[model samples]
Target: MTLTLTVSDDVRALAPGFTHVAIEAHGLVNGPSNEAGSALLDDAARRLAARLDGRAPHEDPHEDPHMAAWRQVYTAFGSKPSRTRNSAEALAKRALSDAGLPRINLLVDLYNAVSVAHLIPVGGEDIDRIDGGMRLIRATGREDFVTVSGGEETVEHPDAGEVVWCDDAGVTCRRWNWRQGPRTRLTEKTTSGVFLLESLAPMPVAEVTAAAAELAGLLADFSPGADIAVRAPESSA
Candidate 1:
């Protein structure tokens, strides 16, 4: 059950500084949050909230340089940044204001905490659910994107040449890291999965590597005996 992941030439040509860290873990115990993990998430939320203390997310200071690069990716895909913000930006904005981050599952909460703390967009997908391999590439506009909207399952398509994460099935994520498809989302049954940490410059490859290591450490502490493999920067299928 090996998962192949890649970043396409089009994406690399668009953003030369782009880099991703992938983590493949198995034997995870997915359940409600545990005491230690919950505590870590809480502490991270508070610290991130303090960092954004009274400023709205739309302001210049609220913008993360890494996320800003993603905005450019969205623009290249014919999406407006004001309308569809990258996931990291939206989460940081929520933490900055009264919205606040809510606990989902253990895996989601852990990645969300890291996303806010480091201002990087992190994506987690259930490896078992993914069909074939995954690639970061420009879309062809006919690919299916299965997602849930208003409690209903629906299918959407990306614009031609839009940046997306896809598999043999269809689009896994549209507009880069904006939203994840419902088919491959992480759930309680997800014991093994792949997590990606995306970064752009001035963030540096070293920082992204450090962030991936931190996530691997947290996963180790929470899922004790889980087998985890960390794939470093520039690794692809």
Candidate 2:
């Protein structure tokens, strides 16, 4: 079945420049992280470093135009950008840090590589686990967001007016991509998945499409014979 994604009108008004591309694939070959995956992450870090162009290693990630756009969106939604950064900024900081990015599984590593190298937000979910069509919308603060705390399952609610990605099940991601719920996250055994590449103003739709293409290529390489489909970047505005 084809997975559907939509950005609500309210979310478009909140961030008029919001654009996204979706990649859905089946028959994937996922496994433990390996040498190739580590190499990809290393190369992505180098690319990000080059983009920084001598900026102080300790400098805030929001200095980048794309990240700055995300910060503004976060503020518009009543979230403190500093305390709750989008996934791309968080990954970029870790990539530039001495500790470097963590090696998750092959699929995670591949998507993270694309995200850091392109400096855009990219996320993957196990397609089989999604309940129905996913929608990006402002939360009512009463929707359930199932998560893990201290190794136990827990449920939390998003703040009213906060942007979230949800489906028939519940909130899959909170605070406009700040955190992904554990329910639909990709895992080592995942054979089918959907990846979303998101961007805001100052980052052209062309760049977003390019990032999605790069990710699709990487997925085809790592998961040979997988049926991959790349949707054109669509603006919420």
Candidate 3:
């Protein structure tokens, strides 16, 4: 692995437009960092959810409870927010200042905070047993874009050119805004979690690393009681 990263051999098969990211870390929770982050998300969640009320639907084919609010906003915008940078930022501004849910936890809220504030989809899965090495590529209908779990809700046309984060398991995650990853998700009974700050474009390795540090720092400052580890994609020899 290069620079502490352990990349899978599937990199060679990735589509030309996709960039891969992977991170692994461990840390202690309940400190100042965890507390502040939790609060920030709490506050943001309340405001965001309120704004998304009546607008965010429970079933958008790309259903995610944590992202129901933001997804509602995306649906309002027709689900095509230009795929450019700052899309998250626009959504966050609308969500926090406008109005909806006052009942989400801090972890989920903070994820929304970063996602909307930065215009990137941030999502995670339960810390379950993930089967194999993951790869990021395009879904040539071979791997269609399924939004909600149980293969129920899926997008009819997922911007065909858009890159998707998939594993051998399936269309397990994505980058447009709300991400889904087997290892990086945080859920109930979760004491440890990992966060990935994916790039809008092929960011320099330095910048990507820097974003990871800042995100971890933000968590430490806000959610002062949760353990968070931030890292970069695994490097190869």
Candidate 4:
């Protein structure tokens, strides 16, 4: 059972520097990097570039007004950037201090390690094998997004145009490339992971790319590997 990851062209267009950097780094290692589990992430800098491909992103979240706008939406929608306060994320952070070695369901470990490894936000779902749906598009100004734990929900659309990734069901994830769906989420029993990689303001382009790649690499490293890829925005023109 090989693992597979995929990304949208929108994301690919963002981080030319990081992608180039990763490719070079892989080449420098003078070895093989299996494609199955490798992941990719991109945001502000990469998206606004002219070439639309490289190792370094063009903009940082803090400096990108578009990103800042999304942050506001993330907050309005009841989701927080990975930098926000959350007991679950905090606990996961503490656990990583001694994450030791990766030896769980290949997909699970792949992204979980990503969570701890880059300290950026990476999310996935059991789409290929799970019994639910996911969505990441913007609300129709009348969407009814029911969260994992029943509670009030709010959302803000991005100025660069909201990049939504949804399943056959509802809006699982929101924003162009932030947050994730709680429904299509992964579990200990997960064997195949379909994920969405993300990075937010204050985090470096290098870090996000590395985190994304780590997941992709881990998937490739597994006996039963995974699918790794990147996704970007649809352009604001």
Candidate 5:
């Protein structure tokens, strides 16, 4: 079955430069992090360091044009960008930190690598767990957002007017990539998934496509014979 993804008109108006590409894959082989996965993360950190070009690790990542654009969008939706940073910015911080990025699993580590290396927000969802088509919209603060807190299952609601990714079930990601709900997150047992790579203006759409392409390549290498397909970048504006 084909999965549908859409951006609401209101959200497009809020961020006129939003563009995203989705990669759908099946027959994936996900497992614990290994030497290969660790090497990929290491290379991604080096690439990010080179891109920063002498910027102090302690410096604000939002100073970069791409991150700044995301921050502006967050602010437009009543979110504090500093307190709730986009996934890419959050991973970039860890990449630059002495502690380094945490290795989740092979699939997660792979996408996190692309996110840090290209400085774009990338997320993956287990397709089998999704109830219906995914939509990006401004929430009314009443949607169910099931998440984990303190190792126990919990339910939360997004702030009114906040941007979120949802499906027939409820919110999949809240705060526009800041946090992903646990229900649809890809796990080690996941064999099919959809990956979304997002970007904003000052960062060309071609670059976002390039990042998606790189991710697709890595997925192919790591999950050989997997059926992987990438959708063209779609502009939300």
Candidate 6:
């Protein structure tokens, strides 16, 4: 089956400059981080630390035009910018601060590293767990959102008109680049997955394409035999 990732017409009208690069890779051997994976994470952490100097992401997430554009989309959907930060902003803040970044698994750590380094929202989901194709669209306030809260799995629903990533099952991510649902989250057991590199205007398509390429290359090196395909808004696999 062919997996597709797309933004809806309404989403386009809301943020015409918004674009994303989707990458699908199979044959991943999800496990502990390898030498190459650790190197990539270390490199990204160092780069992010240098950029931080002493500033916090919360100081002015809106300062980054790309992040500001995402905030606009969140606000348009009734979410508060202060409360809901995009994934990249949140990760950068943590990586730069004393808290440091969390070393999840091989795949999550790699993407998180890239996200902080590039200052863009990147999300990875297990494609095998997805019910159908993925999409970015405004919610109707009734889509089921399966999430884990306080260590227990529960079902929640997205607010009406909230921007979300969804599949045939329901909402996969809420508040645009905010939290992801537990149903399709990437874990150590994930062998086939999709990665999303989301960006906005002022962030050139070439840069985003490069980020996607870097991610694919890293995966190729860490997970030998993985079949990776990348697709941007203007380019196909």
Candidate No. with top lDDT? 5
Candidate 5 segments exceeding 4 Å error: none
lDDT against the true structure, each candidate? 0.82, 0.93, 0.43, 0.41, 0.95, 0.82
TM-score of 6: 0.91
Better of 3 and 6 by TM-score: 6
Per-candidate TM-score against the hidden true structure: 0.91, 0.98, 0.51, 0.44, 0.98, 0.91
lDDT of 1 by residue, 39-149 (tens): 766676676656666455345333656777778767876889878888888777776655567777888888888887777889999999998999999888999998888
TM-score of decoy 3: 0.51
**After superposition, candidate 3 runs with Cα above 4 Å error:** 1-39, 42-79, 82-90, 100-103, 116-121, 127-129, 144-161, 178-185, 201-208, 218-229, 233-237
Tens digits of per-residue lDDT, candidate 4, 1-237, equal 323233345434332211211110111111222233233212211222322223242222222332353355456545564564222133233432343233334354455555543444456566454334443344454443335444645443333334455544545555544445455555544444555555443445555566566655655555332334443321212
For candidate 6, lDDT tens digit of each residue in 1-237?
569777788887777777788889999988876676667777886787566564653454356677777777678779898788889878876766666777778899889888888888999999999987998898888999998889998999988888899999999999888999888989889999999998878778887888888888888877899899987454211
Best of the two (2, 6) by lDDT = 2
Worst ten in a row by lDDT for model 6: 54-63
2 or 5: which has the higher lDDT? 5
lDDT of 3 by residue, 69-177 (tens): 3343334423443343223444454454434223244555555565543334445433332334444444454654445556565543344444455555555554344
Clash tally, candidates in order: 0, 0, 42, 48, 0, 0
Query: In model 1, which regions exceed 4 Å deviation?
Result: 49-62, 235-237
Between candidates 4 and 5, the TM-score winner: 5
Q: Residue pairs in steric clash, candidate 5?
A: none
* Decreasing lDDT order of the candidates: 5, 2, 6, 1, 3, 4
Model 6 RMSD, rounded to 1 decimal: 2.7
TM-score of 5: 0.98
For residue 79, give model 3's deviation from the true position in Å.
Answer: 8.6
